[model samples]
Target: MDKINLLVTISIIIIFIALFLSLFLLTVKTAHKLSNRLFAFFLVLTAIDISANLGDLLAISLNMRIFISSFFFLQLPTFYLYVLSVCYSDFKLKRKHLIHGVTFLIANLVLLPRFYAVDEDSKISFLANIKSMPEIQFNHVLMHIQMLFYLVAAFMILRKARKIYLENYAGASIESLNWLFQFTVALSAFYFIALVKNIFKFTEYPNISAGLKIGLVLFELIIIFWYLYKALNNPGLFRTIDSKLKLVQDIILEEKNSNQFTINEKEHSEELLKLQHYMMEEKPFLSSSLTIQDISVAIEIPVRDLSLLINHTLEQHFYDFVNAYRIESAMDILKDSTKSKLTILEILYDVGFNSKSSFNTAFKKHTGYTPTYYRKML
Candidate 1:
């Protein structure tokens, strides 16, 4: 088969996979129901967009192809909402979310007078000289603008989620946040390539445009497979942060500027010593799912004060502060001759680490050696 025919076949397979995954996400039993549904909707919209690329191969009518193209405006917005849902546990679809559909509505309205209101023959003719059609140009511009806006918004949400996760929690949650961040980065790269492909579509070089289209189909196939692997192998890969949680830096800055707030260096130092003593004696870091709030209540310190002491005064993220203790505990156990027979996994679990990868990372970061290597040196 010719390359175009091969790409068309691959596109068909990708569309099927996307749809199948969408169905799976929609029906899968999980705590992240809203996130799953939003992601499922995003996949359905992606499948529709991919199907639009097969219009010529499928012998779809010009008007139908144009209608299918309008769905592109919704794809990025749906993805942005999915990112929000995954990042914030408290995210709920409200009336304000409908604003995301504005571009889709406007695109359809643009086509209403020019293409959708006309006969099939007129649509064919209009598509024949689509380069000259103002409505078509306007819709293309709108699609690019919407893509840029939503991609930026999605990335901002992921960044904020990462900061919040680092400041408020510890353990394998960072791995899940990193996975989501990497996925968003991959999708952003894909969108960038798609943008280039769209730009190439209007160029004089048909070969480059066709090549980009084929490349995009292959990339989409790989991305879908990657998604399936992560979804199946790591079903619990995404953990949510409360949307109400503010970054420690923001809270510190707000307090610093507030006239009602005053610095008590002596009291702060006492609290720091108390916190360190509590950490060492109580060993609350032994909880894999430990949070700043948990520490706050245990030590009778307010959450805000604890955050300030750990994040601002100590200049350490809550995640790192907690993991430091866990790593230190693991190191002592590793050095003990009595625990020589214990596996690295056992030590990690005993020290409150949920994932071996995270444990190894923290170990290496703290001691400049892997857990096994550190244990062997003893």
Candidate 2:
């Protein structure tokens, strides 16, 4: 009815909508089934928490209120496990995971008579006389401590995961987890603010406490909306850990192969010759976005074999190896007097260099002179 209540109600409603959409998106949009399922269940728990908060605000029935509040202890652990799921490629929900539900069970048992068995009016009276009960204050303190522990643990998981990712993949892309990290950090800030607000509750500066509480709610609402926008646009954000692990494995295998000679050196050498022939004839590198994977497929060689041939045998990275052929082609075009009328840009384009700067740089690197200077010398 009042502005403050209206604001709170609106924010809660938005959070509800976000939870629902996030659940649906996590299940239907994302391909990472295991992690997605875990995250979806986490959202379900969060929705239950929000429902409990709504029930309390609306002064709902005592039994229903206590049932919802019992879920409070389950939220942090579920979320902490979700972060682990996101990080570890082999993560699975084991039997030991039920330990996380212990607090919820205990909370429900302890609240059996205090809140759950009471009538609606008596429940409201109990909430009003909360200061008379030290147990409620203790529960709040324990919840804050649990929340802080999991927040730090989640960060540690991500930090370790990031290190593993970089060590395994030479060209590893962190784009998928980058937004997730932002959301995690924002959520941590929300928890920190709530903790501080509770600590300074009875202080003279009530405005600071009120402002932080309000800020935390607003922070949550804004992030949920941002998440919705990101989810819609970047459905690949939750790619399977298996897929990520496979990529890392491929890179590591390639690197290892580069260190040792293949047993079938004759066959591999033949393949390398064929690969060079294929590149010269096919000119796949002309495509600006060419990757080792693409060339490997075209040349009918395993990506690791191709990487080994290029890096160890030829002593060049894939990009440089391809660019060398492109430069050689450009040189041929430059030396051909029949194409004297063609502009240097035209020659670069015809030879498959995508941009002028790239053409100039590659030309200089290979030829010791810029395209214009080389053409002038001719």
Candidate 3:
């Protein structure tokens, strides 16, 4: 390998280690059982992806044909894992997912004969001599078909994730889901790009193999490692429709009413403090795209708990609670002792209100007057 490839490989190894450690510590330290389990699933699948490819790049005592043959087997499971990990919602284990592994094993059985032959002295030569003659490679065709299924499965996951992210505009886990969705989509696209470059190598495309290896394979390693880093370091990158899902699941699984179960006031205060900090320092509310989910992520709280706390504990709904803060800040801005030349509209957005109409409606709802009337009174 060239020095650049060596550098790239080392960097990816470092990142993979970091992700593994994050996954480890998160698995151990997280009090939330579901989060810990899902994170473990993420780590296991990512580890499989990395480990399968590592045999190729690292030293091994296998002939080139044997190495290539094993790689073909390895690639199947790696792609299957990519589909499975991104599709995972609940941390619950399923027996059906085992079928993918079974199929991968069965595929190797069919492929094993062609790639390995017992020589006259019973020594196995793991090279396909059929390539020297015009011969039908039926199992290769079957492997291609299996790969297509993996592609379809991954694409289906991407579609579902996209729909959930788009439809759950009000919910919080959308951002996390979006991160997984984008990464999945990007990885799939890169794989397809690689596939295309592989196909075009014979069509007068000079250096197509090199281009595919560099742009598709090595870059895939980099992107997937980066993905692990993001997902491990920021567990929020795995999006579940937490509020709705929790409500549904809670109805089924049920929670015991412990009289001792009280809202943590200190944690609540800390979250509100974080929200206040965001409002003061970030001004995210002016974006109109802002929602309770966004705040939950920003505050590092579960959306289901955040919603319940906002409604039952705070005795306020999200909209009223947030708009109150916006309006109060706007009030301070409007009633400033210094002469203010900016319009009420400018002040509204400045205070994180998305529009003049929303600002006016919110001000009137809170204090029984429009901004103009309130400003005149001030």
TM-score of every model versus the real structure = 0.96, 0.61, 0.49
Comparing 2 and 3 on lDDT, the stronger one: 2
Candidate 3 lDDT tens digits, 97-139: 5665654466455544444343433223333343332212444
- In model 1, which runs have C-alpha deviations exceeding 4 angstroms? 56-61
Model 2: clashing residue pairs?
none
lDDT of each: 0.86, 0.68, 0.56
Would you give me the overall lDDT of model 3?
0.56
Q: Give the poorly placed runs of model 3, Cα more than 4 Å off.
A: 1-28, 31-91, 115-148, 161-169, 200-207, 237-239, 242-378
Residues 113-141 of candidate 2 have per-residue lDDT tens digits of 77767777877787787655565776677
TM-score quality measure for candidate 1: 0.96
- List, in order, the clash count of every candidate structure: 0, 0, 2
Model 1 alpha-carbon miss at residue 286, Å: 1.3
RMSD of each: 1.5, 8.3, 11.9
Instruction: List the candidates ranked by lDDT, beginning with the highest.
Output: 1, 2, 3
Cα lDDT tens digits, model 1, 181-218, are 78878888888888888787887876787888888889
